[model samples]
Target: MKRQVIVYKMEGSIVRRVIPSDNSCLFNAVGYVMDHDKYKAAELRQVIAATVASDPTKYSEAFLGKSNEEYCSWILNPEKWGGAIELSILADYYGREIAAYDIQTTRCDLYGQEKKYRERVMLIYDGLHYDALAMSPADGAPEEFDQTIFAVNPDRTIGAYESLALNLVKDQQRKRSYTDTANFTLRCGVCQIGVIGQKEAAEHAQATGHVNFQEYK
Candidate 1:
């Protein structure tokens, strides 16, 4: 998403102010300062939800009334976008090596639609002077690795890598559980009576005109 901030066009001395949005990180940061500002977070969440439902033509202002469905779908689908990266490709890109991540999922009602959205939070760095903080629910993916790949802001204002890594961990956990069940079921079936091993099972299945399982062995 293209965030905009207005600054005075002066030549020398330095003084710049940043414009805040409902979805701005400062919105969350204020929580650290106050600790009792849950109301603000709640209010911003609602406004952001609404803006998301409205589908603002310009992303500079507070994104209000936007549906989580739109946000989730937008991230998955590359055509209708806002420049944020997707979780799948993000995990594959950065989580491949470390296997560590920090991703979160939240749900909100937008335009009467309950939407489940995913966001990635991470630390981004460069061998330079300034640093940035960011939040994106997909939409801003790059062109080269577009399909399912999340986009990284050029200035590293946001972190998508951590979220990607978190997603990968969850996926792996689910897959392992599923594989365990499948293996147990196969073992039970193959060890029945005279079925001694994979080869025996295959031979019995073939001789008896049963479906010879290619994946069983």
Candidate 2:
């Protein structure tokens, strides 16, 4: 069998590659970044609603333009999405500095929260969509990027990420996105032989009719 390679170059170092399986990309991105895996848009909406409601003095219309009732309804609706609003509430809740990166320019763009000394996390934007990127585990692949930090500031803008800078996002776009995998082993459950990655795992499964797969620590 032939080997599938992930093309990687020096641009912006990504911590981890999170593919958006659904519209919950923004929520998933945030969850994956903070070690917070709660990805339901409605559940996320509820969390923020309660937080904002508890303190109208801190979370104001400046942050939430719509009334609490209306805002809650909007986020709960699957059609409505999450972005900076959700990021800010979460940053405040977690007491971390969330950095929002505008990939178009090589700068560490806007951030959430005014207070300094907070730990940082990353959030990426293509001008229309949002996703999460973080540092790979210590035992991960692409050794060069193991310690890359993705600190972002929390900021909100509608329709701001519609236009993506291909050059900036090329690394995390598709199959190539798996470029830097953390140190783990993908083994074929049937053969007990180790394979390199997802493609190999799929090919091995197809050729040997082995559907069972496992990842080892």
Candidate 3:
């Protein structure tokens, strides 16, 4: 089906994705940072729980807002959620620094950064909500890569890629050179069928009498 495409502007052009809406979005986002796997999401949750359990000195009651036992109990519960604090724990666990980009405040939050990591992943905060960061070259993704971000400013600054990671840029160069490149599909929100192209997607909307739409990958 026809759908609108999304593009991100970066020094080395990259693409991003939205993730499942759940209490563990931050944790799942961290899991995505490692390898973009959903099965890893639950594993990440358990890792965070265990990390805190083993290092009470680092994640004390003050930081946890409850007794160590209570906090560990809460961590085991899926209904309970995590945030930058969890992100911090995860940053150290991964032995890499993580930056959280808050679009509302236009700032990036740092956690567990030591020199540089083989991979860099970021968590996106849209004011009141959180989403996972799924970035690759706008044109195409590489089999593997690494990154380091030099921020433009305290606000509006985003993650950056190392020169070596520029290899990903060559893979999908035509996918998104401009907003009008139109490398997206439109799916009917009601029926979830793709229409083909932008114009056709629009016509499908009118013909099928479907009002809601989501950008198809």
Candidate 4:
């Protein structure tokens, strides 16, 4: 007869598990910093820099690499980027973990009009170049049309909506006749919501529970 030895511990590319009690020290620190007036966006950047500098091996360029410039540009100039810089930053931070988490932003940009004018500008996970397709708004309808969808990568340590800035959405729509601004309603793909003119979007919402909507004038 042969005796077998059992292993209790395992290590991998990311984190190792020890089955220990949870600690709230890091959480406290995050809250404390956020509560302070000195903790501006620039200050957060400094803190991030310090954290990365102190642990080069853990936070190498290859590990935390992202197009911060592009993201920032979007924040300052959304018209050019189509989406906000904050969204891109979030995507840059969280995009890589999509496969593991099974949760990534589903962004879309619509161009042109009528059926033939519709186009899909983007449909991708944040850190990856591969694109996935969702059924168009016209999927089950009489016509099949395409639309652009670009997801905002969330921060790995801090998921989307954690930042207060995300809540500060300026609902502004330009009109040639009137100067009225309107805020958009955010929905998830997993919800049972329906769109008036787009069946694909409604079907997508039913399947995903959350969906993003932006009407152009």
| lDDT (0 to 1) per candidate | 0.29, 0.57, 0.58, 0.28
Q: How accurate is candidate 4 locally (lDDT)?
A: 0.28
Off by over 4 Å in 4: 1-33, 36-39, 66-217
Top of the candidates by lDDT: 3
Which parts of model 2 are misplaced by more than 4 Å? 1-16, 36-40, 57-63, 137-217
Tell me the TM-score of each prediction against the true structure: 0.18, 0.52, 0.57, 0.20
* Tens digits of per-residue lDDT for model 1, 81-134: 111222122222223111112112211101101111232222111101001222
Better-scoring candidate (lDDT), 1 or 4: 1
10 residues in a row with least lDDT, candidate 1: 123-132
Better of 1 and 3 by TM-score: 3
Q: Candidate 4, residues 1-217: lDDT per residue as tens digits?
A: 8999996542111111111111212212122222322123333343444444556565444654444443333223212211222222222332221211101222222222112211112222221112222223432432123222223332222222212111211110011211112222323333434344345544565566444544333
Tens digits of per-residue lDDT, candidate 2, 146-214, equal 432333324422211212223345544533332223333677777898876556765787689775656
| Pairwise lDDT winner, candidates 2 and 4 | 2
What is the descending lDDT order? 3, 2, 1, 4
Candidate achieving the largest TM-score: 3
**Model 4: worst 10 consecutive residues (lDDT sum):** 12-21
Q: What lDDT score goes with residue 170 in model 3?
A: 30
